[model samples]
Target: MLASQFSSRHPSTVALDTGLSLMRVAAPIIAILLVQDLFSREFDRKLHLTSLTYPRPRYQFLLGRITAIATLLLFLLIILASLLAVLTTWISYGYTQATPPDLGLPYVITVVFIALDLLVVLAIGTFIAVTSTTPSFVLIGTIGFTLVARSYSGIVALLTRDSTLVGNADTYQSSLSLLGYLLPDLAALDVRMISLYGDWQFLPDDWPLRVVSTLAYAAALFALSVWALNRKKFS
Candidate 1:
């Protein structure tokens, strides 16, 4: 009862969104602020490594820095995610002429998936930032991830599917299903089609597969990011 009630709460950026807003805003946090402090900041023209070796209040300094960076990013991302979600909702609604269609469940689901996807993005950015010791590398990696995911999504689908179904079938269901399954599968996670026009739910048997695939993708990406961070030798 309690869980359902909480779930029923009005749609907001923090709740359903996979935290894309935070991830989007997090670039400045990692690059501008955190990187400057951790990699660039120096007392007197000395290397940051100097402080690392001769640390004073090392633990407190690091903790405060991380907290400040994360907090700044969190709200920024929340706003961004919320704005995009609302924009998508408004656009779809205008096209469909359905106000709060399907009790706004599709909107709800889309927001949630976007937020979850951002969690993976954040993990990648944070890990890269810490491991590379330079925010430039991390920012580049994050942008690359986004571009690859968005661009390849359509190409992969076209190459995988038979010509007959390519035009009408679900984008992910075409030749792209393999890569779609491998990466975030933003196509599947995106419920925009439903918002625009109804009759879009996946079958019961395949629904579980979708859930498993998404969970696996998120876990795999997050684990890879953590692995990269763990191997980093802060020197």
Candidate 2:
């Protein structure tokens, strides 16, 4: 009964923790690996040409795979979010001070942002997978890109803040900013604040800009992937 009481008092907190945990694990890692496997498996089995023979435009195949993978990730997120809603509702009902569970707009929007973020990761992974000769290379390259993309914002921030360097800070900052524009800023797509705060007030004022930037980055990566796949010659 003590555990139940604890849950009752902390359901929202628990739900917030769950959402962040799920996003951290699902968005940048598991989803990327799964998407990478889509193309890696084709190459591994030497079925690239055969797979391409399906009655569709070249880009159709790529779009279809991306859509399918994104849909699967969305489905998983829905399932997890639903379970969290149910658990939070059940637990919070017993406590007098507990705020009612809200898996509504805030929760749903967070899931959408996560889905979009995973879409970008999928594009990057797909590009790496199509360009790589082996599955190992695909996995390694995707993971490396994921790490760099996700952390690029932080790395730039650190460099721009440090004044101990002998170089002119303005020049360093401008260069870093230019480099950042080219790098995928995964940090922008993060919506964890909504999960924790039960509202969008905690989100940055430029959240929409972040979403637009992420989509643009995804589009560019996808274009590159299509170009690479078209040029790729399979044995």
Candidate 3:
């Protein structure tokens, strides 16, 4: 359905754009499930107790679980990015766009940013898994986190552009702006336009800040998860 909407554009560009968009949604769900399985299920089935019996410190166990989940996500992202690249290339074999889509560095950067975005989701999921008593909260909390973190920036921008759009635009913008500090703006990490249009103009001026913010947010959540796990009791 989405492909048909983009039928007027370059097929390869459309394919890459649509594929990455779908991935932006799918990756978080996959990461949530992986974190749930790694952390939540272990607690649920009492397997965590056996793992805790090892000589290693609780932090090591938590870190090891995080590492394993991150490695799997990286592997999956690589495979999907490679497949998308190949598919895009194949589609563009004979045809040519007025402005050729960049399948080079731009595409690679887009994929990397997407991976970073997924890492934020993974971190949140891991945090919830460690901190929450209910296994179901891990899924629900992470999904809610992703939705708000990804869209809040856009919502705030809309409210800013037209204050009359809302009855209490000032209050809402102030609230979301405060949240902007607390949440990593995952929307800014979206660099798909750079790849889709092969235009440097689409490159975010504050990309370095965005990258740092993402890493810092994920690292903070991870540290909190480690802290929670170290103190967690399996009753």
lDDT measured at residue 59 in model 3 versus the true structure, 0 to 100: 92
lDDT of 3 by residue, 25-113 (tens): 98889999999998998899999888899898999998988899899999999998888888888877756778878989999999999
Winner on TM-score between 1 and 2 is 2
Report how far residue 149 has shifted in candidate 3, in Å: 0.2
Clashes of each: 10, 0, 0
RMSD of each: 9.8, 3.9, 1.5
Please give the RMSD of candidate 3 to the true structure. Answer: 1.5
Residue 94, model 3: lDDT of 52
For residues 1-235, could you state the per-residue lDDT of candidate 2 as single tens digits?
2234446456555655665566656556777667657878877887667878888777887778878887787787778777766675665555544344346787777777777767777888888887877777766777777676777677567766785663676676676677676776776667666755566676789888888988888899999989887787777
Q: Stretches of candidate 2 above 4 Å error? A: 1-11, 94-102, 155-179
Consecutive 10-residue window with the lowest summed lDDT within model 1: 1-10
Report how far off residue 55 is in candidate 2 (Å).
4.9
User: lDDT for each of the candidates?
Assistant: 0.49, 0.71, 0.89
In model 3, which range of ten residues has the least summed lDDT?
1-10
